[model samples]
Target chain A: MTGIELRGVEKAYGGNKPVIENLDVQIEEGSFTILLGPSGCGKSTILRMIAGLEKETAGEIFINGIDMRGVSPGAREIAMVFQNYALYPTMTVKENIEFGLKNIKVPKPEREARVGEVIEMVGLTEYMNRKPQHLSGGQRQRVALARAIVKKPKVFLMDEPLSNLDAKLRAQIRTDLIELHRNLGATFVYVTHDQVEAMSMGTDIVLLESGRIRQQGAPESIYSAPKNLFSAQFIGSPPMNIIKAENLEHGGASLPPGTVSLGFRPEKVIVSGEGRAPERGQISFRGELVAREILGDHAIYKFKTAFGCIHTKTMSGSTVEYGKWSVRVDAKYLYYFDEKGDVIK
Target chain B: MRSQSGVFWRTFGKACRLAVNLLIFAVFFVPFYWMFLTAVKNLGQTLRLPPAFWVSAPHWENFGKVFDAIPFFSMLKNNLVMTFGIMICQFFTVIPAAYAFARFKFAGGRFLFGLTLATMMIPAQLVFLPLFLMFSKMGLVNSYASLILPWATSSFAIFMLRQTFKQVPQELIEAAKLDNASEWKIIFKLMLPIAKPTIVTLGLITFILNWNDYFWPFVLTTNNAVRTLPVGITSLNIVDGGVKYHILMAGNVLLVAPALAVFLFAHKQIIKAFTYMGGK
Candidate 1:
């Protein structure tokens, strides 16, 4: 069963230009789906539409198999953790977590019990009496999470909840979020522009651009076989290196017709000395070394080849001279795109 | 040698700031000192050539004489009722109006807010005659309602509260909405508490303005039955005869006492409110 479904959803702010147009997505029950895109790509708007904070200018939204056309956000049985946490600054941790329960008029004993349990689950029992201003960023984030979880709603929507934390804390909380999702078995819809978060935490990644869904699938599948040029370049760090297929010296290798560009991941290329020979089913190029950036464990080397400037990630310990070099790519790992940037399968 | 010069410059700057502050303080404090000195002087001492800086014999009777000259307690009661009535009415009227202006998007939201702020530019004197005529036509003159009704909604209060309310993040309101809070609950329980400091500051300003107001009460009331302290004090002026400066100064001191006490206790909050405004 789908936990949430948006059919032909469109949104516009007092103008003919819709921020989101023809957005259709189905979030499977108990799955962690991420709406991934660059800033201003309408990812957050999609989340708000699902939460009923924003009205769709066209089409319908369904949550938990019920039409959400006229449903208030509270009536939809969904809880959201905002990007800034949005914890009530004047309320104590315990009060913040219990606020929703009180608003719904849960009995006193049950409300206290649930609040206490959530406080322990988020490791905020000792700080329950402290206000949000007294808590650190990570602690405040935990309070937001606990506040959302205490309600135990049908769907949980989070809008880049960990973006405000430091790098080390973000990584730690990322793992905590995955564990929390597994333990709760609830549907989670998250929005973020960070490809790393989408790749690491999402069970299904929906790549969006210009308010349209580019692709939706498991993270590994999207990373390995992007359906178009945008997803291929957007989903990876240092991005995919593209070269004009006609510029390549094919060296007797048969080229697919209408192949305007060729793309391959940086990690898939092998850099070697100038005198190296290409192995079977491999294409080799000779290029001048432009620059090398050492990124702790691995290094990225920029080379100016006959095609264009291509980047290759290699082991930092490799003893390659900074001069003329040879790089090889296996034919099976190469991607071909037509003039319109759609991948040629 | 460099560190010594740094110390010298710092000390010189501190001394200059202290001197300027003292000069400003004395500029304001002299008038209050003169009022107190004149209040204690006898009638003969007040008219003396030197204008007795210090009364040779203190006349504490002057304060009592002000009460005898006018219905002082009745006027005090009227002032309290008028000020408190305006304050309460403004709380109800300004908050909801400000919240609507800040949060909701409706037709003419901007135009209506512009209209409300435009009221602040119109001097109160320009509208006094029309307002007085309206109140007299309604048979509201010489009553507390006449003084309180005109100031029931203050544009300045609405504008200040709206600016403060706009500063609240929209996400917080959305969070409250998702938490099952009604619109009124979101306002009274959430927005109001977070904006408590500014609200208190607005209340203090409204109270002080109504308390010190002399013109409106003087225009609206015909007798001492509904007159406030500032208007009632004018009875001690004794026009076309020898003026009783001591008794007049005593009335002035008493008139200034409540406002002075309110400010002394709440100056920190007023300063904080203005600072918060500057920050935004």
Candidate 2:
């Protein structure tokens, strides 16, 4: 199994401020680990360092338990799929996949067999002779996948490989990639800024902010028990809402010392209708409806309260009208946070 | 009435464009037409009134006489060697220099590239005297080295090829590197194949410029044994009486025919190169 570990990685371009510093991360073998962060947060930088494409200023990277200090990208036993697919524009689909085999002196018969098997895996056998420019975007993406898969490296690193595709194609390829990881059983280090993608595709998610890891765990654990305000807001689709703790009722029970904010997921909120009040021992806020978003299966309603603005998502077909409304969530679902945004369990 | 007027103006515009195109074609074609006509004309026909567009008695022997007037075959061989020597050498030097300029960002890179562009501004005539003196000092004045070595690498070619190389995406090279390809493989198999149009354009330009050159070889070599055909044709001018224009034109036809054939075959690539690289 090919696991990867980065200890104390630091990166700076020229003499400027470091883009990433003192970053440590571990990717378990055969796990789909997502380096999830916003743009300029150094997620891609870490992936590049693991691939040996970019040199880390200070760190030791171990791939498959081997020190990768001076190993070239080719010798690292890893294959990379770039964001743009990066297929050689001058080569046909077959040539692009077979070029690496030819470079390593793989026997001609084996090379042909490997290329054929991989091309069929990506369903690009019919377009084997077509150049990249002639193929459509989805086909080109498949060819890029075929090129990477034919290498059969111990580790696979993908840097937002599905970002360039349309939404429908991206979803389809995302499913394909999950199946691919399962079949190959190879470690995959994927970098993406989209939290939805991170939540859905990753087996182990490493949430990053700037250069530091905010949290690292399985997707369900991170989503159910966010460690901090950033993780709470980063994981969910409209994210968790946090309001100032002052003047908010907490069932008359005392909060932990230094607790300054209250948090709850939008889906956890129960929008009160039929003029009914909140249930006992639940935290409630009174506000007027400000906005509405109608999704196919559900709708998100925004409200403005005396404390602050918050949102509640509910199943569709609910006739929640405009004007004064009260939404509440059980006290157990509420997350309390300190002044510095760290969660208080 | 307005639609009829619009049709009239459109036809008028097409007529005007056709007239201008034909006029431009004549401007370029008349020189070749006159050269071929005079090459096949006798001495008296060359000086006839209105400059006879058609040769009455074609003097096809004039082309054969060109051999007797000067060492045409030897000079022809010299021309071929010099042109091809510069081309093969230029190809090697330009690809590496341009690749470095386009791909790397070492210290002083900007200044070095600026210096390359600066060399293109200086006139060749300014250096011809010093070049000839230097070659003579080295005892290489009459050798093919003096003719070919001076133009082994062209700054214009480097600058042009650098622009073309820059347009190739950086990801292509990085992908090749990750594929375990050697640097030489990345260049010969990848960069060279991608930049084919610009390279072919450079080749055609190099051939035409070297084939038509007269003054540089004239100042260096004293005899037809070492000089190119352009310089060799000078000996044909002082025959019979004074300046035999017909025979001089016949030698020029032989010197120019090969370059014309090369251009006719590869003009498509030339146009493709200029169309893309010119806008940049």
Candidate 3:
């Protein structure tokens, strides 16, 4: 397993403005690193550049400490699983997994042996004779996995491989991919727009916005302590609730100077009846309950307050009444941001 | 009462549809029927006043007379060589050209594609004189090279296959590249197979068109040895300054049989190729 690095990478089509410019990124060896961003944010572009499927406008890329200039994607020792699964439609499942190995001139016996091992690893042996069109989405996705796994490349670059799978299957494959990464101990550079996939699967998350790295660190750190307003709002389900500093200050919360926005996790906020006084060193707001979304284990509450709508996630069957409610959060959990949306801390 | 009327109306509609279809079929079949009839008739029956619709005695020997009048096997060989040569050469030219036009975005790509399409719109009839002159200067006229080389590359195939190849997802090509397949392998193994229907349809279209192509080959070749079936068959129309209608019709029947046979066997594929043309 080897790490990957991109230096001063820029990408643009024709004379149009650059989609990505001067972007630098590094993936540690044996780490499941995620390139996470919104659509058109150039995460997939970066992955393609790493895989040498795309040529950057002006950049140097390295895989396993080897410069990738003039190195074809095949010679670079990387395998990619695409969003559409990209299984050779004309090939049987066995052939689809074995084609890559055969292309690199691996011996027939070795190719077949490796292909069989990967097929069994992905649990697709029974359907090995079936073409991709004949398989279900999950099964096709597994074939794509088997195709990449059989190559046994230094880095496995996946561009939203799990996005096409249904939710349950997505979850199942996520677990499988994590376990596979552990067992293979190969570097994985996965690109996805879904924050849930990023947070759940990536050991290292490189958060991106409009082609620039917003923050890069462990997924837990990126969630618990975001570097900017984008990171704060992007990582969590329902996102972190953001309120203007003036409103929070008016609601009797002390704030740092030049802090224009305040943020706190929705799950961190506590919802209680309106009559409950604010606890010491805690900030509270009184508002009418406007909506409730019961999500099995917990429910999300939306309240219309003086500043704006605020949301809180509370365990189901709580004692909060419908008409008026109080939203509270400990002062220590609140995040302060400046006018630039970067965290003040 | 409503159900009874509905059944009557449905039956009437079916009858009307059947009548229209049969009329259309008869209109198209009349030419082939006339060819077959003239092909089996003697010169006396063919030249009869008010044209006898049926012959009392069929003269099947007229078909044999066609081969004796012209170098039938040689002309057949020339046609086969020229048509299949153009087809096989097109695989060398059109597939790679169409693939490049479909996928690559080099400088002047749009203008180049525009030029390709512009050439397609110019009918081959318009280019024959200039092309014949070029071939004559190159000493290729009056030879098999003149016939096969002139129509070796087709603008129509490039356009059709370009449209189909453009619809092949870029992801598939990228996936192949990452899998260690070279560019040529991707084109031959992945793209050619993916574009099989279009290629087959194009091949059959080329076969039929060139099999019956008269003017281009006539403009180039003078001798019977290199002349294709159509030009050679024209000799049957006038042997020693006398018109032989029966023999010429028999020669035409020979020229048309192979194309018709191919169409009958692969009509489904042809229909499918056209139904999903451009992109699917």
Candidate 4:
């Protein structure tokens, strides 16, 4: 009953400027689905629509086999955690968690018990008496989550709930959220602009751009085989280098005699000995090292090539001389895009 | 000791602040003081110059005379009834209208709100005669209805309150809605608590205006039973043959006292309302 199925969902503001068109997604009952996109890409809008915060202009939303057209958000049994952590500033943590329960007319003792359980689940027992204004951003976010989960809602909608936190806090909360989902075994629809969050946290990631879904699949499959140019470009950090390719026949791409456009990850490029130039089963690019950023475990190198600039990374303790270098690329790791930004697969 | 220049400037600045405050105080108090002195004096000294900075003795009997000359108690009662009635009506009506305007997107809401604010520019004097004749035709004349009915709706109250309600986060409304709360719950449980200061400020302004109102109430009610305090004081002038300065001063003091006291007690809240209004 908790699984969500959206069929040809269309939304527009006032019958014009359609924001989302023909959005079809099916979420498994207990799966964590992340809606990943850039800001203003209608990711949050979809989450709001699912939560019933927004009315669907033209679509059918089904929870289990039940049509959701006449269902209110409260009756839909879905809860949402907002980006700003919309914890009632005037209400204490305990009261905030109990607000929906009280509204639903749950018996007082049961409401109290639910509040206590969710407060413990969120690790906010210490802050139960504190108003939201007294809590830090991370604590406020936890309170919002507690408010949502205390209802034992069928579907959990999170709209960038962790975006307001610091990097370290976001990472910590991400793991906590995964653990929480596992424990609850409830359907979770999370919206975020961070690809890393989508990759690590989503059981299934729905990537969006300009109000349309670019791709949707299991996180591993999406990371490995992004469907198109937008998916390939958006799914990874230090995103896939989209090099334009010349004429290529059947296989992947046929490199022109001199140098066909080649794409390779930084880790895929090997620092070969000067005598042993890059060989077969590998594409070669020779250029001066334009830039070097040594992150803790991996180093990203910017190589100035004839095509333009190619970004490749190397393992720690391996240093490339700036201003001049030759790189041996693994042809297996290469990605090719046509002049139209479509994958040449 | 501190340097003479630093001390001098510090003292000078302190004196400057005090002087500015005193000047402001005088600007407000001077007319009342003149009225008080004139009320106490006999006809000969009533208008005597540099305005009587001080009176020779307290005229305690003037208050009794002011009441004896006019049906002062009835007028006071009428004023209270009208002022309190208008404030109550405003409280009930303005909040809901304000809440709707602040939160909803119905067509013509902005236009209606605009139309409401436009009422502020309308001169009250222009409507005074028409309202009086209308009340006369309706047989509401010489009754408290004339004084209380015209004040039931205030555009300023709605405008002030909508601006207050607008500051409440949309997230809170959504949160309430998601809980299956009715629109009424969102207004009473959520909006009202947040807008308490504004309501009080509006109430105070309405009360003060009604309490001191002279023109409309005077034109509407001929008898003392329906007359407001300001108009009642004016009626006292005729009984005293325009020579009982002490009695008139006593009546003026009585009329002004309640408003002054209310202002003093709620000064902080008034300032806060003004600040909120200015911010909007």
Clash count per candidate: 0, 0, 0, 5
Check candidate 1 and list the clashing pairs: none
TM-scores for candidates 1 onward, in order? 0.96, 0.94, 0.92, 0.90
**Cα miss at B18, model 1 (Å)?**
1.1
Candidate 1 local lDDT, A250-283, one digit each (tens): 6555668888888999989998888799999888
Distance (Å) between predicted and true CA of A39, model 2?
0.9
Q: DockQ for all models, in order? A: 0.86, 0.66, 0.71, 0.53
DockQ value of candidate 3: 0.71
Chain A fold similarity by TM-score, each prediction: 0.96, 0.96, 0.97, 0.92
Error of 2 at B154 (Å): 1.2
lDDT of 3 by residue, A1-345 (tens): 349888999999989999999999888999999999999899998998888888899988988899999998888888999999998887899988888888889999888888888899889889999988899999999999888989888789999998887899999999999999999999999999999989988999999999999999999999998999999998998899999998666666668889999999988888877879989988888899998888888988889998788888887676456798788899899999999999998
Q: Candidate 3, clashing residue pairs?
A: none
Report lDDT (Cα) of residue B244, candidate 4: 63
Tens digits of per-residue lDDT for model 1 on B1-280?
9999999999999999999999999999999999999998888888999676776679999999999999999999999999999999999899999999999999999999999999999998999989999999999999989989999999999999999899888899999999999998899889998888899999999988999999999999998888999998877997357899989999999998999999999999999988877785
Report lDDT per candidate: 0.92, 0.89, 0.89, 0.81
Candidate 3 chain B: minimum summed lDDT over ten consecutive residues — where?
A: B235-244
Best by DockQ: 1
Please list the Cα RMSD from the true structure of every candidate, rounded to 1 decimal place. Answer: 1.9, 2.5, 2.7, 3.5
Assess candidate 1 and give its TM-score to the true structure: 0.96
Name the candidate that leads on lDDT: 1
